[model samples]
Target: MNATVAIIGRPNVGKSTLFNRLVGKRLALVDDTPGVTRDRRPGDARLGDLRFTIVDTAGLEDADKATLAGRMRKQTEEAIQDADVVLFVIDARAGVTPLDAHFAEVARKIARPVILLANKAEGRAGEPGIYEAYSLGLGEPVPISAEHGEGLSDLYDALREEFEKLEAAEGPSEEAETDIVIDPDADGEEDDEPAGTVDRPLRVAIAGRPNAGKSTLINKLLGEERLLTGPEAGITRDSISVDWVWRERHVKLFDTAGMRRKARVQEKLEKLSVADALRAIKFAEVVVVTLDANIPFEKQDLQIIDLVQREGRALVIAFNKWDTIEDRTEVWTEIKYQAERYLNQVRGVAMVPISATTGQGLDKLMEAVFDAYKMWNARVSTARLNKWLEGVVAHHPPPAVAGRRIKLRYLTQAKTRPPHFIVFCSRPEQLPEAYLRYLVNGVRETFKLPGTPIRLSFRKGENPYANKAKKKR
Candidate 1:
């Protein structure tokens, strides 16, 4: 409703490039790589006399490579349905491939008007492809070079015409609305905890893997043997969401049975434990993932972080039994490096090195949960966020791909729970995944968003808004 346009197409067809172009800067990476974009990237864009929001989608490769069109395909279709207008981009260089034709069929199914684009038509070599693009049955394809910045004037004209029709047909009452809500944190606290809904106090889930002191730490944090404490693995079979208050911050700690791999969960109790812990993760607003200092980085740990990110919840990481580790210096360095490398998406992710038994750094651990919770509700103003991004890019330049320089254009927040941003750039495909990681880490450290996922996406701009606003006058 607030000026959104969706760019939908098959892989590597310069949709992202067109995104950057309309945005009037390189906010995305333009590369020859296909299926590089895995998520839909939304950006504020302007084209000639037209200014609106645009969304660039992941190439439809996963659909082809998929074993089945299950949940993911359904989600993708929903996302497409949510869009305003669909800019159907096709590769003018390759002409209309079978994939492109398939995409056109899908586009036709949507309620939105389709704007066909024959991108990568800079050279004389692409003229034949431009002609062939018309056969896809979405009306005439506007030829434009996403890479070389050619035929953009014609793109502006086409877009202007389409928007004019849209304006004429739409109700005049449709207007953008803005509100300033100052307090989302007040809503973070559980209603039942404060309201006394249950006489048995609160139910909190303190979950993690084997021997990360879920029992020992909960015991230490609670100062009791509420749950059995032992070095033996898989002792806590059922998830016990217990009640406690830390400095008057009421908590219902769920001491869960240690979760092992699904195949390794041979025992019925262990399976029950895993299931309970998973349910706890879903129910609880804030989930703390514990890690052993000795072996911190693991595939399961990363998966846990991803789950938290997807759940739109708050999270904290506690390095339990940190007091037992002798080589503290090396461990901290390794842990920091691994977190930055593996969990870059979790911006400002809270990392606390705590010893449950010794009670060392327990206060810091508690502090982190409060902080991460606050950050989960954190909203950065457009002015401050862009300012912060400007400083970050100025400090560390973007990485170059091949001979071409990667350009990061204007940046803005798309949405937030765990703060998400869209970076308009040239050659969004050309931008390396690692560079996106760099920006994520930078956002985490700079914005003080630790222990939360900060999604940073590169959007390629093409049809680069040919400054035809002057001519429109």
Candidate 2:
């Protein structure tokens, strides 16, 4: 991977589809719904012989001051600035919407070269719209059907041209920079647990809207008021972190400042507080988004889930103040349903209804955390995976595509942390979502693991290999 090519566009324009195409993996979710993607999704991209780093970005919406969309816009702009080439995608069939124009205008400000991609252009329906995309004023729209694997030759040509320009002028893009800033003796207060007892302690960040029991949960977990909590909002600031010992396991716990809706955060201190909280999330492996049981579902809460998915981190959603809810059963069901409905990108997210006050379900919460952590670290033996793959195909066969039954040749666990398995087969694109879920559910059931996010991607290939890549992180 050399050049950093960012997949950019308005919502639902197949940017993620093209990213997966080049990356040779379903690393990002592909849904028909607009604004499905909400964060910077970086993948090791291979466009034939041209290997480059591709960043799949959220749709750029013209958001007003103090909104989730506004925050996303800020993040997306940062990604564009970092990119070497911006692949501006537009939905050909949908024909340039108003938002498309807005995005194109915004993209012109970036110093990098921008190439327009007219996606979903396989059929006759998209011909006129593909031609219409020339109005974006970047360049000729490279018509591509990302889902059907059409029009990569043109994309390859465009990439080659950009690389040549950079080589001739900029003298070959620099090596991948080390982003980690190791502060061996960074001036900071100590956490609860001793430092050296653990090997790479899991970084778990706790976050939620103001007064959402985030500090309370941290206090409860540490068995002390390590972080100050108050009825007044914004008690914790500066993103205070501590090392925690849970059942002999060590974790570096980041108790972040309370994130409020941007509008209410008028003061300078509050804005810095929000930024500190965001930084905590960036440095976390697993984020425990503690929600107020009474007021759980908010726009900011959905944004938090979006952040977790974007960061590619395992999440354990803890509904705090569970004891306060009057109709426990009803509220719990409703909250879970809403979470599922809103955040569907990461399948099977671990959601626990627990009270941080009384410690009821904290044991279950810890148990769930361990399960999620294990799932994150889960590595299936290749021999065992293929063996189980054979059994799954033999038992409940893949459903018919048009007329022929889908043929699944083999399977391999690509990567894990929520256990991502890839099945190689004939007509993988045609494979039903129900069939894929059936296999994923089967794998979870077979392993006796439930409630952890399990991702099973069906690809049309045999034995894809990463030569020196280890099975587990």
Best by TM-score: 2
Highest lDDT model number: 2
Indicate the worst ten consecutive residues by lDDT in candidate 1.
Answer: 192-201
Q: Per-residue lDDT tens digits of candidate 1, residues 258-358?
A: 66656677755456557767877777667788878777866766777677777766888889888889989988988888887887567447788999889
TM-scores for the candidates:
0.48, 0.49
Q: Which stretches of candidate 2 lie over 4 Å from their true place?
A: 1-196, 235-237, 260-279, 327-351, 394-396, 399-405, 432-434, 462-473
Every candidate's lDDT: 0.70, 0.76
